[model samples]
Target: MYSRALRPCLITFQVHGRHFSSTKQNNRRVTVIGAAGGIGQPLSLLLKQSDAITNLNLYDIVKHTPGVACDISHMNFPAKVTGFTGPDQLKDALRDAEVVIIPAGVPRKPGMTRDDLFNTNASVVRDVALAAAEVCPKALVGIITNPVNSCVPIYCEVMKKAGKLDPNRIFGISTLDLVRASAFIGQAKGLNPKTVNCPVVGGHSGVTIVPLISQCQPAVSFPQPELEKLTKRIQEAGTEVVQAKAGAGSATLSMAFAGARFAFALIRALNGESNVIECAYVMSDVQGTKYFASPLLIGRNGIEKNLGLGKLSDYEQQLVKAAIPELKANVATGEKFVK
Candidate 1:
């Protein structure tokens, strides 16, 4: 799945029984803001393998950030790895970054909802957005910090205030929902999870997560009750991890994989690849909300086009309808935080 998802540096094409190798160098500077955190560490490791990235900057307030970077540097990837510790060096980490991914912030404990993470993560996102606006205003930003339904709005509001808001370039990394949906659907149907494609829309939270099981690629079907059960499982999969960890951590490895997958999609698009589509939470008018996550065609300048929600099954329709109010409230909470 990783190899297929991430484009390597070299490609061989065959023509008229002759093989040719094309070595296209994709040199994009990528920064992982919370490099020492649970998600950031694994995420940085995954990004290192992508030939699309030329520089991988890992930054954290933790003193061990440089150690993490040093550890990853030994892997012998083409991308050069650097670490910046403390707020004093954040500017250096973000400077000229083409893609900025923020997986920094606290993880949800066993009993805590994503909303419970708001106070701390919101502040962290706001500060990082402010720095990004000052240093790399045009960089593609992916917010992985939680209460994502709100944190994304907070990041946008900060950028907007800085007169650097480009709605298309800033994204809330909600690929985990899509990943979880695909995995659950695949397990139930006995298919390869990598080949299963499911589009999860709405916001990235409890009730706001709406999976379009009816529209899954390969056209999978489920009994109505089974469909509802699968959808609920996808929605609450993060909590499942948190509980299973017994408060150790929350969805770090899976979230890192999902975050890396989404980041690579953005990198591929930025490198002029066509039809690079992925779902991300971003400022939008879809579903009468300020921010929504749906399938998007990513291009060099960011969102090329938004493929809005397609034909919805009755159950899917109800899920979306039920999600609106909660999504609005989350957006309101985020927007209010910026003010």
Candidate 2:
């Protein structure tokens, strides 16, 4: 169904067998905290196709939870599907999972910024994230909740209070920005997005999203004005999707693709894959902030190495400078939520 309607741009990178990969396809349970909405539904569907997952549980307050569960269960993938419709059953949905991807909370709509979503989704994601903290304390959490710059700090603080927060294991899924930047750049320059890598840092919200196009590998130089246009385009890609959708929702299908891509990277790292790197907003001291995004090397234990900000072009440096205040403000928002 997804293939017929939603084009899958990501090509899976897998090294067959459990000895080299983290995918057990037997006992490892993975859970989705909010699996009913636009992002969640597509993300869950992507997870349904993962071989590393043996059990897939979904938690959502929506009434259609069981129907979504039933629908996903029909997939030929080996994972078993279960749905928890409310907070009462949230524990059941989260129990003993090795990985949890939270795409819960409201998406950005017309006239609202991702930060504007903080008022509504902050508590929703925090509450659901706390359940994962309690039920699967050690699970690697890939947070897809918006205001991610802030919500991640919220997740960190709440998990800390619950005595389950692992700095390395909790990641704010910022792969979408990188995905979007690469796609946009690729389209304009006619390069394959899969091979064009751009390092996007700072935060996941507007103005806070900093794409280091200067540091792109297999590099190409953009004329100064063209560079500014490309950077602005990458930064505003979320709003581009929103305005194009005309109040329907934010980037769902593309985000779903990015979510799947990040999830697969996590699975590979856990399996001891070497040279695995993905960008995510997470706790870091690389830029004087408690959390920042840069390239991170993943291994059997989540983040094995934090690759600090590499050399940037003068224009890129200014972009980062401009983004810091916005990113810092966003981080402070989530931190306050937890505090």
Candidate 3:
């Protein structure tokens, strides 16, 4: 059970100066499993700009995967770009990878829900997880596949069966929900989105996406009806983009940006940066669910601490209550798929 009376403590860190290093031991390799896809390409591009990565491995079954890696390699960054196409090359791509991010999967059409993407994306995630288990079992893995609520569990189940399960290391990338919540709240309150911080919890799906506007860093208030509308918009932002694109795509650009943000945060944490924090869905006892998304304190070993849900409003409490059953069903779906 969550302690509704507890408020999350703010963490602050100071960096006196910036330092750049290129030693062999300092090298960090990151792998993108679906590098040629809509989210993967842009995400790989963003990560290529990072100084923390020494190698970026882009893997996909598509012939042009190497081409995508080549395109990103031209950029003047520290990370060396490598492309691995098809199953035969996946091991090479994941070899020595410190962090692995999976954005490989199909996108949603106008009327499709994230759950509708389960069959295709779940298999993609499962195959990648199997390879990761064999090649880089200890690497920090981030799942960006659709129906993330289920796909995350599939990855975990695979890793568990392989006897390499690390609940702290595997995460369902739910940062996009927080990103949308902050952006929507900022838009509604006429505040700079970057300045607004909203903690989105629960699973990554329709009603399961709970944005704690009451706990937003800069306190904000809205009429009850307005609050409901804002929450709904944040929950369905992906669908809004899908409908806007008219079946062409589904929130690829923004999802890429959010994915890159989460990946960078993980990199920072792995580098032993202090006070690093982010929200992600992972195996937890919080909220009595097998998996839940909440603010997490990221450390050198992945999740150093699970910052449990703090001080929910009555409305927010109800939202969380409504989410549990759906989350359980989603978890069951993923676990059943693997079995």
Candidate 4:
């Protein structure tokens, strides 16, 4: 379940045009790669429930996607579901899609870092991203693939090579970190988690994930020791989930929820709504890093504006400084993999 503040209900807008038939005329066509995976299934389910989505396409290397699609189609939601399996069907799945989300990759194990999952996942993301480029070049692409710090650049590289790269439309989903920051801080202060909005920036791995708790909305303060402890815990939350699952899985459900939340924000933006904002990792110029996560204003094009990291406390500034090297190395590894 998501906090009310975190999950807004779907909004429908009236439409007028000789070319349009129903309210669904303007809704988006969304495609999900790796739709049978732990994260993809729930994310698809959430998107299926949204009134803003008119058609949902599911694709995966695994053959189970049809069964997942068949099951989800039984739901009464307005979004029609279709499943595509294997590389042969990839183009069909991506065709006409306005929004494409990739969460396909191997899950992380207890002792492994995100960088460790890069070998298998990088190719997975690259192939899928390339397919999107060939078939749905204008789609707003949201990548939830592991080792996002690297995979995002890998995707960008592929898109660039194809000459279909729309810098504004490519995004790395880092909302899970923001979700964790708000939840943890709210718990610590006995405030409503739903009311807590924490802006998380930097990159999407280990120490690179920076939670700007100092800029939390409805401002609150923490002792220096507690602040340091909370920051570390937020940074390592993914590992904590991996260890807690005893190697059976990574953070699937919560991640699905977070991915859905970001995707919906995109859908709203595409619907011509204004003032929608969320935190995302994208090709950025913040702090001279090649790609950074910052508060982004989402609109019909994708990232309407990059709200650079607002003022950071000395400690938070140090966190950003420490993240740049690792972030750069990860990004280079991805770019190299593409070449």
Top of the candidates by lDDT: 1
- Candidate 2 TM-score, true structure as reference: 0.92
Model 3: weakest 10-residue lDDT segment is 5-14
> Runs in model 1 with CA error above 4 Å?
1-23
lDDT of 1 at 263: 85
What TM-score would each prediction reach against the true structure?
0.93, 0.92, 0.93, 0.93
TM-score of 1: 0.93
Residues 1-339, candidate 1, lDDT per residue (tens digit)? 212221231122232322121225558899999999999999998888776688999999999999999999997667899999998899899999999999999999988999999999999999998898999999999999999999999999999999999999999999899889878988999997777888889989988999988778756999888888898999999989999999799999989888887887777778787767888899999888999998888888899888788888899899999999999999999999999
Candidate lDDT values, in order: 0.86, 0.80, 0.85, 0.85
Model 3 deviation from native, Cα RMSD in Å: 4.0
- Clash pairs of candidate 4? none
Candidate 4 structure, TM-score to reference: 0.93
Displacement of residue 206 (Cα, Å) in model 2 is 1.7
